[model samples]
Target: MTEPQTTHFDTVLVANRGEIACRIIRTLRERGIRSIAVYSDADRNARHVSLADAAVRLGGPAPADSYLNVRSVLDAAAKSGSQAIHPGYGFLSENQSFAQACADAGIVFIGPSVHALNMMGDKIRSKNHVAGYGVPTIPGINEPGLSNEQLIEAAGGVGYPMLIKPSAGGGGKGMHIVEREEDLAATLETARRVAQRAFGDDTLLIERLINTPRHIEVQVLADNHGAVIHLGERECSLQRRHQKVIEEAPSPLLDDATRARIGEAACAAARSVGYSGAGTVEFLVSDAAPGEFFFMEMNTRLQVEHPVTEMVTGIDLVDWQVRIAAGEALTVEQSGVHLTGHAVEARVYAENPERGFLPTTGTVLRLHEPSGAGIRVDSSLADGLEIASHYDPMLAKVIAWAPTRLEALTRLDRALGETVVLGVHTNTEYLRLLLQDEDVRAGHLDTGLIERRLPTLAFRGADDHLLAAAALFLHERALNASTTAEANAVWARPTGWRLGEARASRYCLGVSATDSVSVGVRGEPGGASVTVGDGSPVAAGLSAGHDGTMSVDYRGITRVYEVALHGAVLHIGADGFQMELRNRSRAEELAEHLLSRDRVPGAVSPDVRSPMPGTVIAVNAASGDAVEAGQTILVVEAMKMEHKLVAEAAGRVTVNVKTGDLVKLDQIVATITPVNTPDKGATE
Candidate 1:
């Protein structure tokens, strides 16, 4: 069939936020197309908003009031004079109704047709449709409106270890694995609630669970013409709680024949639905059967991990999406498609890995993205930018490309090591640990790998050298901010002060509020002597490098680090983690310890504080309610994920915040007074 001629649009409005919107804007700018960005109150000064040619405010911070409000987005498009709208991966990306609305409003939706979306957006319907075309599909029940009793009955035929998934959503939300019949009812209810909240659809599908399968998805592209093409497969097996964290192109699991088979299946699936633009046909490849894979779902929009495929294929997927939306034909045929080199992408999120990967919110005190021949960063992070809990926690995606898989792994590891994000706790250090794992490096992967290896990936504390570096960096920053005369006097400090001498300052630095390290320093500028912990004074030289890194030489070892000083906090990018340090006095530290220790015995505060800023989804506890330790007191929804605050000790609960109330970090939503329980030390 002949391809259609290209249709053009001058301005495109991006209906999304953060890195993906920034990504689409970059492509739009490259094509000489003006981009319009829509922002919420939370994203008023976001990087994406600043990057676009013009911007419109959608509404308030919460997504429902802003991004997900179809009227708000369409109004912004009309006001901005945008000819088309590009819905980046999340939010309204796969919303069939939104696509239909855009089409009705005469604004081109940069995705598949509304009909195609309707078919693929519903997991149950898509599976049935694709199965008719001989596409391998997992055995499942797709009928909607089935009650709990009906679902339980259907589960018997599907067998144990089945999965109940929301028919209308992806990203593992509203999905649960039921191993036994006893847990079916509760899980089913929870799944439906999450599904209704996230995707606005309570209907679900039940499917037989494939044991420990590798998540492989084929990237497919189609034009308005009848041509469709597959850009090979991506291994997205490394996930936490079913959310993808690490992804790579040219999956290691598939042989050429298997790869070709799956690629063809993906193309067929796309063609069956008349899919256009960029989309991903996901499959769960059976671990026991190497060549066996089943259709999972189709994401009818550009994926977050699309860059890894771009790095391998040497094609700009976003550029193609825009061109295709503009009525351009498929320029490359299946025969012309080729994959080169290996590329891996790691999603860096603003979360505390040690705290059950709970999402965190804070201003970006310092930011440093790795730069090299093989490293590519798709991000909108900047110094002083707030990591809001109202959106996705992903700070950025770091992708590395190399000639070989091993080399790609090596490059990605190095890139991650060089990257730094401070102010908000992040998973950068955790990702580095995962990359270094033997199983991960060897390509022995599956969806459950992260959950299994999580225990061994515990946060490693900073060493003495790192602490010393932080202390020195803080000292230098202080010296730089002083008056010229004061700075000169700092440089003249005596270098030969004896240990324990009053002239030799003994400074206590806190890694956390509790763990404090004592450091003594003598001399200044080019050469100095630093004493860390209880060790003897060691001669060291501290000097500022040209590239914002601090050069430090202690004893026989030498190292350079990127350091940023924000008030009393020292954000140090050293080794492979972002280290945060605060200077405290011995008296202060002791006082805090004493206060904590003497806090009226047995009168422990049972307050369940919101760990991050978010809206209260549900308050499960009422005043004077008896609750056990580990019982959920309230649930807070943040960053599109639900976090339940549980009681730390058995206690009587008191609810403070109601549902829909906006709460900040450490804001107590509920208080639980321990019932005859002694105050145990805080849970580690």
Candidate 2:
């Protein structure tokens, strides 16, 4: 190991967005380097833009128009006089053309060399290349330029229960598992479509699906001086749909000898490609045989879970990336690299886990991130920030470090419990539930763990207490507004006072589109008796804090809740769970009841609304077309994921949205009039 020397770069542009961009900017500021931020129209007021020394607008909200536009990124770098461009993980980070363009323009790309990017960026080529270095790879067919027919022909040798993966992209995108030979062709077509759209390459690879597999990846750092070292391994076994949810360093499944062996193999793969800068080599290790590991792929950029590695190793990976790009040598030796303590990170995504993990969009009305000993938050969240559907659903990452793995998991769970995101629905509660799983706590992990436990995990819904608190908070707000408007008029104040027995002020609150609760409050908000639904009346009180948090005393239990009002809906967050309660008027409730009663018995609603706001990528059914129940109507794409809107009942369908049409959440995109039922005059 040699003494580290300072690297100089007056200005460097970060060619990415979100938490990764914010993370990189912080490192640049600490190093006294001017940071330039590039943003799309969707991220005009993003946190990273504000944190940087200067910013340049890229273009539209779409990735192709902004983040993925290599020409625009280069122009921004040149306009800002940036000597180097640090692509933070996604977009053009592992893009060989982008790296070559940077070199042609005399701007340093803060990532691996073009040759390394080309070799390792494609999973098929990398798998073949690594196997030449004596690295073990899964038994699969990775021949490049294989058509769907060719892949189907080769599926027999690969065997059933094989994985079809896109060679050009990482992060589990365009990856599918084929359980039967009959499903190979259609799955291959779908995988190729996704690959072409996501990575601009439709090249496919077939791999033998290792059952009970553990996703372990080793972080490696290399410099132009031919020095490469592994920073230990990260356990990313907890996943759903092949996407990582939680990650930890120094895998519990690996003994010291196995860790060393895997680390050496990772180094060998990097050396084979002449890799430089921060990168990750992913491996699929069998849970049954932990010592046997198979090469999955090599990500030619920093991974999203790098913080877990940094927390345990006490190394700044982004700092090293910049320094290595500046022609600095690796000062830390492999012998000196040590993993201390334990660290765990849970990604907080802007999604509704209960609703099949659909992407969610909202303005950040209230934000609260946890902070304590060994707790770290790498986030792109801010007060009033608008979380849109244009980018990835991940909003932030919450990481915790402790002396032991169990303690780290505990701290991470506690931190997630303390996390508050009011307006947007997030996976904070889901992350906590996953952290508390018995298998997770015991380190009995596998890539299939989250998917298996997902059905059993009980996600908290809007319970009675939460509903009571929300009703009381609304009552308090109404009372204050009335008092402020007409202080002298006692009748104007909603105090529930009457000539005889005090009348109860009734409120119809909609917890969901179909469910509404009737809450009656007698007396003032400070001291009131409330009854929700058919439950008994209970004593309740509400108090406001200067920090915008409200304390609700419901059923003799007082708890603090973060509250924010967006339009007609009230967003309340507590115990890492968030619920939106809409104050429904008497007329609205009556209309809904009437509509329900008028519907045909056992008939689903004719109007089909979009579950999420996104662009309609495909319309499977045409207007006036007869469709069966569960038939696909249209597909909506948001946050790079496609969700199919299907018919709820057999009926004559009328599609309202066309391909490329942007639809809002809950917007009626189609209608399915049940057969034999009288035509409802146009769907509301």
Candidate 3:
């Protein structure tokens, strides 16, 4: 029954980038606080930079040289005259040293105390601390002085199907699941190596892999004055590769009793560490046992999925975090905290889920965010923004909140359908499909749901409508490029005047050079007929708008495509599908082949190309060395994840790039020549 207290700060520096940075800036502006943003070389013109009151450049494009550099961040904070620094999640948000450094510099760190951070930063310590409060925890081991051999022995005792995890990392980095003992050593080594590179800590922890466990994490807010309260939990069971893809609040499976228990446990975890500000205490709930849950890990910062909890609670977590950081009391009591409705958030990422969820990089030629009654899109993207491979691939977070879970799910699907992003390939359509799954619709979810349904989630190739749209878009572009006089002259003549007959030209339109479809187009001006790969012709009416959008009408159905030309590539956005088209006429195709004489069939070198733009982290083989099929030849770090390139067949290797060298997309990093076989007939 107490009025809420408020604290005032004139300026704050955001020590991160992307959507989270933008989210914080919004709250700061709402509170009439000046916001400062720090950017890398790659983000000189980023949306976050433009939205801030002022921005300071850190260093290069790589995170270490920029966002993750503590001294540079502090320097920027000082230069901007910020009274507080909000370390957004991911980049030093949970770093205890960073908090201490802020204190040392007399700048308030908008997070928990260093003591709480130190306790929760290490998973083992946090688990042990919470267990002392009678909170159940997943069986795991992390010893300070254990050797690799001893760690392996300890893992055996924990039982098989164990998870090798990085003790100091999150976001699914440096985590591996081992099904048998034979693969433990290699998995452990790989996990440790990646962990060291990512978190600068190679410490490993072994834990039991709970089968079909639901990932539920409660949002807790505490103050320096010792008041703590839980804002309910978010259901993050939908995941891929241990990383959450979709998150929701008021888990359908959690009865009132179970929800209370988990919330109390989370508060206990927070109180045990003397937690302050916004923090999340994650727990793994058994699907079969319902009420049985165990502590997973605690994220001592605002989580990426915090919006769902905010949506249901009608509270601004960032505001609360700032208030708490300003030495204010937690005015809201546990009884005052209320959950209103259901909410869901699907992370829209710049990744091709169809291709093993590989991160994609390109210039964002166009971006269309969706908005409606129940939809909220938090993003920091703009047209012509270059999506680099240095940081996380998440482009935006689309959240839908409604009175019920089903309505929220339905609204999320619709919102996802309305999203449009060109140039960079995204997983919007993939998210929509996942939302439509029967199990997902019914709230039957688990941590392994996505992995189990990946086969069905793979791309099934573009449909007829997509091909027709591509062809029509190209045809319209060619017409638009012609001079007014030339276009008039062509229109005056017959439909196929060049061929001396009314005939359609069969143009080869393809998603790629190899994946193509033939479309027959015949028209004069303002009208055309398009037939897809031996299908019946559909009469179409086409017109161009001043904004480069093409309006097409076929069989009483009208569709508008936002088309843009970037050199030889045509970006098409229609019907929630973003496609890149490369059109080639028959004559042009022949000319291209005739002019290209470098490649010879059967004599072509089998070079292993970098799948995406990244830096070469390691080279496992040198020139003239032999390698077997499926052996890792090189390791590439892109979008903060390591991708190991393996040989496709037995061959002699030829490495092309040195470690730490930046490589371009499709750049050849190595080559493989098939092993020679004996000429048995000649020898005999």
Highest-lDDT candidate:
2
Rank the models by lDDT, top first.
2, 1, 3
Model 1 lDDT-worst window of ten: 490-499
- Residue pairs with backbone overlap in model 3: none
What TM-score does structure 2 among the candidates reach? 0.96
lDDT of 1 by residue, 1-684 (tens): 766667789999999999999999999999999999999999998999999999999999878999999999999999989999999988899888899999999999999999998899888889999999989999878887898789888888898889989998788877799998899999999988888877778998999988878999999999998889999999999998789999999998899999999999999999998888999999999767869999999988999999999999989999999989998888899889899999999999988787678888878876788998989999989888987878889989999999999899989999988887877778888988899999888988999999999987767676767766766766665555565674456334333244464355556787763457888776664666788888988887777732258888877688888776666666676656776677786678788678668677665455677877788989888888999989998899888778889998787888898999988766877877766744587574
Please give the distance, in angstroms, between residue 92's alpha carbon in candidate 1 and its true position after superposition.
1.3
Error of 3 at 198 (Å): 1.9
lDDT of 2 by residue, 482-523 (tens): 645455365666677767787778878887767788898887
lDDT of 2: 0.90
Kindly report which residue stretches of model 3 are placed more than 4 angstroms away from their true locations once superposed: 1-7, 458-460, 484-495, 503-506, 533-538, 544-548, 551-558, 585-588, 591-607, 622-627, 652-676, 679-684
Better of 2 and 3 by lDDT: 2
> Which of the predicted structures, 1 or 3, would earn the higher TM-score when compared with the native?
3
TM-score of each: 0.91, 0.96, 0.92
